[model samples]
Target: MSTLAGEFKSAYSAGSGDALAAVFTPIGTQNKPYRLQSFYDFTNAASLQKDLSFALFHGKSLKVPRAEQTAWVDIFAAYWEAVGELLKYEQDWPGASLVAIFTAWKKVANALIRGYSSSAGIPAWTLPCLYTVGKYLRTFAINADIKAAPQGASSFGFQDDVAADIEKNAHLEEAARIINRMFTLCLSDRAPMEESRKWGIYQTTNLIFKTYFRINSVGLTKNLLRAINAQSADLPPLEAFPKSHIVTFEYYVGVIHFLDENYAEVREDAFFRVIGLTQLMQAEKHLATAWSMCHRGASKNRELILTYLIPCHLVTTHTLPSDQLLAPFPRLEKLFRPLSNCIRKGDLVGFDKAMSAGEEEFVKRRIYLPLERGRDIALRNLFRKVFIVGGFEEAKEGQTSLRRTRVPVVEFAAALRIGTHATGRTRIDMDEVECLLSNLIYKGLMKGYIARERGIVVLSKNNSAFPGTGV
Candidate 1:
């Protein structure tokens, strides 16, 4: 039985990504018969079509595995060898040729993907080619109607759109049809290749996304996302895939959620530093690398977001990554710095301004949703600072930090307006100040209860103001 990975042991051994110029390049020099070119190049359409058809027609089907994973590799190798001929298209092939290839490719590709599992290994070229195979159907079908001027018109660029919607849509339909089929094959709940399929599916899904992104179509990925999330409990952990795949998968998946403002799903819970990837973004990159990793995924190229968000004030105490890989998260740090500062000082107005200023930056990074949760950070910090302020100036062992904490709402309101000189209002809105304080205590930023009847704020003396934050 033939195995693509075994054939290119050197490349697979080299880990992910071809050290060669292009990703799709042949691993060891025994060149593949077909090479990829533009969609509009039809220098020898008739001959190319005829030759490819004959090649696929007479192509020998080698006896490979019928068992779980081996069956998939056998099927993929056979299917790719057939489509490999079609991949040599210059630009556009006859609409008939497109139809013929899609049918043949889909029939075989679908069958094998059904048996896909983590039990099998994927060939480097197999995945890249599989993606292109599907993508070309969409691209060439669109260009079929784009003909050159009879006498002579502008013989370049996207001249005109003459393809009928039916024809154009048929091509798109075929592309989606293939994607859906693969989705069912690889992502089934009891999928035979469930374990290995997890990562293989990422490569498959990445191509699907590339397909959708190409036409600038929106929302096509939502269903795909739903399907994965539906079986998320059974889905393998990040450690199951190659570190390289992890980065690419997380990059696409994380960005997908970020763009849609589906931040809560990414965090799913909470920990610290880079709230989005609580466990994923932390400092475990060193152990994960190209092909040599034990089970670790490399850092965000440097600094792994620490397990604990080392407070900006005590950054010195945290174990930092080397400078090369320890780059601070661009947008996360942008939001964290301001939110942390205002919370430390209990500056309500400053908090507002910081959020307003960083709003554009967050949106630009497509992380607005996750960063929006920074609101909780500010609330916690502001109240954290306020708790400190209400404490005695001089500390003594065995004494409660909140000994002088019985304060009136009116006084607390005055405290909020302390740094405001322009308005210089001696009185602040009682409702707003209490509302803010109420939220702080409710969220466990402080340990205390509100005395609505007396309008006095009683701070907790027995424990730290912040929950789980006591000494």
Candidate 2:
């Protein structure tokens, strides 16, 4: 095998398409080798170096003293631009067939990432290389040909070629097979109790799970959980790392459990774990008081709004008053402040607006836009349910009725602690104005019969909707 340095020199000098294609001839008959060479010629070198430096040296794979993964990432990034350009020029090729190839590579890359995480097992700061590798790997996979089983398997217990090969062959189903086998092996020892090296191994396992989670590959996630349970020993509790990861994980798990209608388990297991992780992160004290206040409010731990949520809002603020300042965490303060405010006030309207604003800001900063976009959509949907109840204007099909009205209910009423309103000039949700006409129930509003079925508010005299019920 050629030394990495020698390969780099040869690949670098192989400037043109023919020369680049030559570099990969030794690897295989597949077009991926040529594509890799073409990629290096097209991509920027300095930026790749910078990103790789941080990922490889600072995070996971600290146990493995090699920069090969990082190099692979850099190579793949360049390869993408090159091959994509070539494909763009090749108008004669069928787009559908090429797309299938991309799909196959995507699976292969995911499997590689999971396999590496299982093998390396280290902190995030030390494994930046993995990120770069995984990024292009996933990109390649997405673009690979996703059809038949690849011809180059059984050597590595999987296919031998990179994502480019799969795309060329359109062997997605076979690529998926190889990927699944790798995934199965990677997750074979998922449970924390199965292995003695708890910290790194557990964290890496979670990382692998997160890879699946990121893709919404719930089947893989379920299989991983099963493996963990099967391998786990009936022993004491497990400790987590970075604290933030645990907090984030528990939060997602709780959401899953909640969706599954396992409310009791969510409260008992997920809630406590999240709370503990938050505390461990020193979010309760190390940060500003507002953050602590908001955190408490978000958890609904007490009726009073804790200062925790403030930090989330403060993070978003470009400027803040000296007295109400957030922490000094760059960019984060600006990002968190508005979210915290929305959570603290239980203002679904505010949350929706803030989330949109956050996404725009992230895009402007050239940050990862997709994650924020997904998050924005998620929060928007979440608050939509909490803020407004949709209903049609049920008047005669062709006739507009003046008496037509819609009913509204506060989704967060159970959590919002305040004075009740029987009837008066109350500021109801903007979207739920129709619902307000039928029922104006508040902590200290009008005293009357809530005719929920008919969507009518029977109030006393001087009340907004009903004058005879009670003011």
Error of 2 at 440 (Å): 17
Residue 303, candidate 2: Cα error in Å is 26
Question: Model 2 over residues 1-471: C-alpha lDDT tens digits?
Answer: 122233433443443323332432222235343443444344354575554344334444233444445544544444343344345435455553545434433543553345345444422222322333333343333334332436652221111221222323323333333444444443443445434233233344444443443343434555655665775563224443445434433433332332232122134355654543344233323333323323432432211112222322222221122323435333455665665555444454555566677765433322222222223223323323333333233567786533212222343232121212322324545335333322333312223444556644333322232222121
Q: Please, what are the lDDT tens digits per residue for candidate 1 over residues 1-471?
A: 122323333333454333311322322234633232221132243354343233222233322223533444344344444344455343354543544555555555554444443344343234443444444444543333223113332222221111132323445555666776665545663634433334456666755664554333436777887887887776776577656555544444433433333333354333423343332232122223321332344444222222122221122122222333223454345545665566455565676677689776444333344444445555555455555566563557886443455667776565567744335566667888888887667545567778989998887665555665551
In Å, residue 368's CA in model 1 sits off its true spot by 3.6
Q: How many residue pairs clash in each candidate?
A: 15, 84
Residue 119 Cα positional deviation in candidate 1, in Å, after optimal superposition: 23
- Stretches of candidate 1 above 4 Å error? 1-43, 53-128, 132-178, 188-199, 206-240, 246-336, 364-366, 369-376, 393-402, 419-426, 468-471
Q: What is the C-alpha lDDT of each candidate?
A: 0.46, 0.37
Root-mean-square deviation (CA) per prediction:
10.7, 17.8
CA displacement after TM-score superposition, residue 210 of candidate 2 (Å): 3.7
TM-score of 2: 0.32
Model 1 alpha-carbon miss at residue 361, Å: 3.4
lDDT of 1: 0.46
